[model samples]
Target chain A: MAYSDKVLDHYNNPRNVGNLDKKDPNVGTGLVGAPECGDVMKLQIKVNPETGVIEDAKFKTFGCGSAIASSSLATEMLKGKTVDEALQIKNTLIVNELSLPPVKIHCSVLAEDAIKAAITDYKAKSATPATAQTA
Target chain B: MDNHHNCWHCGTPDAGSIFCRYCNSLQAPVPNYFEFFGMPLKLSVDLARLQKQFYSLSGLLHPDRYTRRSEQEKRYSLEASSILNDAYRVLRDPIQRAEYVLKEAGFDIGEQRSKDVPPELLEEVFELNMALDELRMGDDEVLPQLDESRKKFLDILVEMDAGLEQQFQKHDAQEGDEARRAVLAEIRLTLNRRRYIKNLVNEVDKLLTARNA
Candidate 1:
């Protein structure tokens, strides 16, 4: 099957791919996998803790070409958005943007799943109580 | 799929004779994987027998054998070689073989999202989910609880797996189709439970990984 030119371009020249300090307080990291292809993707966003804005975003994907493109595009969409805005990036939008085929749509879905997972991780960590006041 | 060919070793028909099964020349391609590997379709398969069959067949069908052949013949050889490898991969793994059998039998357990994970797995699934949730919450108390649950569930699965083997032996030896169908249903249920428990264990592993992550 002939892939989209954008997919081939991204596959040949992937951008902004790296890992974040996943344990850092200001980073929201999403890790996800696809059942059909057994692919893994990790997307991370460094958010401004006080303002809730994404200062930077990066991804590392291990799968077929479509998986790489989906993650690459996901990071592109996330950069510079507020953490809340980045979480709202939907799988459907990613799929349409990439014009992914039906069988390859899960690549985009995995990307979306990673974004949600990362944001949820950030929220849960933020909600944890810090040092308690002495009695 | 028509990978059948004439054996050049002695010009005997390749369809029915891999390595002649007569003169042992290592130059024939049997029909499907099971026949090629000389294995019966059974729940309790002998791994040793299966492995022996594969090496023997690979000796005949592997792509390296066609290096001196014409381009057309070499392409056919390569296709057959990959299929041979893929067949072994599908058959040797119990879970993969079971899924292939289920597909051939026209049954889909449904996608993972169909989370209508059978009611039988509810309690175990629920407990697994809770363990995952707690682990996500960074509760150090979760792994021990999951470890205990995993052990109990695995013990049950092992017992069931043994029972199915015995039942398979009996069913294969028995008479009527009615009796065989009944045994098959029982086997299916047992396999289904096994699948669910495996998914549960995977969930627990994911939880542990996330905690460390």
Candidate 2:
């Protein structure tokens, strides 16, 4: 299938593709996969403990153009937002931004799931006393 | 659909027999895979016997034998033969058989758009995919990394295969629907993991072949 220009661009030059220091107390990592397509995605967020704002975001996705584009846009939308605000990033918005076809909608959903997993990891780490509390 | 049978050709009724007694013609309409093979719906099948039955049935239903028969009988022969081939293909493999039974029992084991990646393998799979992407993009420098990931994924596949055998036996040994469903779920998860690993293997092979070319 022909990918839209937006999808091709994001896929070709995916934004913020890398790994975060998962062991760092301020960083949260989310790893997800779609068994059907045999695709895997990893999304990570670094949170500022003092302000509860996201400092940076990164993603690595192994799938089709749509999955890569979805996570690329996910990280781009994540930076600078508060943890709670980042959670509001919708899969539909990702779909719109990436111009993913209906068949690729699950890729967007996987992206959403990855971000939520990252936020959950952040919250779990924050609850631990070792991590600096993000009030 | 059970406890009653009628010969499509001669209208002679038979009680649950696959072939009509009066006309001695195959009469079941679209039999389930197990029923088509005249085997019990169980996981542990005797392959030699299955193969023997398959070949024998194929001989009887060969299109060559139907050329001189009535058109309606010929159609029935073709349909039965087609279903027979499909049934044997699915039943001969343990994994395929497990999946077929699950699907026949109304469970959607997996699909082309499935997104249920096992949680524990996410990190490893992510790294593997990165290597795959790099390889695909012509970064030959990452060949060592790709090779290492392939070995690791292959080990996982081996482990999953052993686990599948245990699950398959468990499925066949279980009696109750609840117990069987639990085993089937485990089988589905194992199959999904194997599918991912297989795709990884295919990707690695592609890169290796490209380099050689």
**Which candidate achieves the best lDDT against the true structure?**
2
lDDT of 2 by residue, B1-213 (tens): 252666777886663444677786656445788877778778878999999999998997776887987787678788888898899999999879988988987778756433456566777777777777787788888888888888988888888888887887888899998999888877777787788788878878987887799
How many residue-pair clashes does candidate 2 contain?
1
| DockQ, structure candidate 2 | 0.61
DockQ of candidate 1, scored on C-alphas against the true complex (2 decimals): 0.03
Q: What is candidate 2's local distance difference test score? A: 0.83
| Model 2 lDDT, residue B167, Cα | 81
Q: Score the docking of each candidate (DockQ).
A: 0.03, 0.61
TM-score top scorer: 2
Q: What's the fnat for candidate 2, on a 0 to 1 scale?
A: 0.79
lDDT of 1 by residue, B1-213 (tens): 333555555555543434444444454344366654666655456778788877876777777887886565566566667767877888887656655555544555444321223434444554555566576777878878888887877787788677766866765676775665566555555566666666556666676676678
